[model samples]
Target: MARMTDPTNALRLFQHAFECGQIPVERGRIDPTLMFACDEPKGRTRFNYMRAEGRTLSALVMFVHSDMIEGHPCFNIGYAVAETFRGKGLAKSTLVAGLNEFTNGLNGACIPVIHIEAVIAPENFVSQQVATVIFDSTPVTITDRESGLPALHYMRRINLPMRRL
Candidate 1:
């Protein structure tokens, strides 16, 4: 798993992925620079998993701390799989691995629970299916705060068990 910590490199990779149709455009424009923004509570964490070490990017999972639900941290989860890697369960597996690392970090920080939110385009059935399968929650139609477009919001609260780090 590759973690994009540099803004310039991250933006470049994301742009290349977009141009090659590896990333979906219907989710609305994304600002990868926000990954480095520290103004928001908990900020943002992104994990870019490559097919090979320092090689081709296969999928990316990003979680942005967007809100607090019932006094617990809430993050918006987003993911994309490379065009050639789609329909192969890559996205689901990548998300699982990425979320594991993310939650491990949270657990180390003493954050035991969090609310995970998924804001997906209404017509993006694949993402909706992934979210439903992973979260096992029904979505509610809501206007996306970032894109100002109608989206299906799926929320699930997760409890993090402590693990030896």
Candidate 2:
């Protein structure tokens, strides 16, 4: 999977994903406002914040350092796999790679902890199963106050001890 480091490239990927309908426009999946949230700025700030990675735009993820339920700066991952790429393990692999990259702390200093959350529709059993395996557990159902959509929140955390080398 290729990790996108350049802002221009990231925006291009986002636009491509949107045009391909990998993300639902009605759900505000790729809405400009949501894409440029305060939690994640626009342009390079957002692009730099999310370690974007994928293969040929078929699958990709946008990850960020955010305060998870544990109140720590853990990686929060959001992804979209093109319809053709589904059931091919690309999503799972991409997510795993992204997690590993951040866990290893490519920049410097191990993050010490990592967390991923997936918000899925209750009827999206396929995605639920995928998340179950990646997260190693069933997701908890939650009411999304903002959209009022019934969503399943899947989460996982990793913590390890090691000397800074």
- Among these predictions, the greatest lDDT belongs to 1
**TM-score per candidate, chains pooled:** 0.68, 0.60
**Per-residue lDDT of candidate 2, residues 115-162 (tens digit):** 666677687676666576568877788874436677777778777455
What lDDT score belongs to each candidate, Candidate 1 first?
A: 0.62, 0.52
Q: Please give the lDDT score at residue 22 for candidate 1.
A: 62
After TM-score superposition, what is the CA distance of residue 62 in candidate 1 from its true location, in Å? 0.8
Task: Tell me the lDDT of candidate 2.
Answer: 0.52
Clashing pairs in 2: none
Q: Give the 10-residue window scoring lowest on summed lDDT in candidate 1.
A: 28-37
Q: lDDT (0-100) at residue 111 of candidate 2?
A: 50
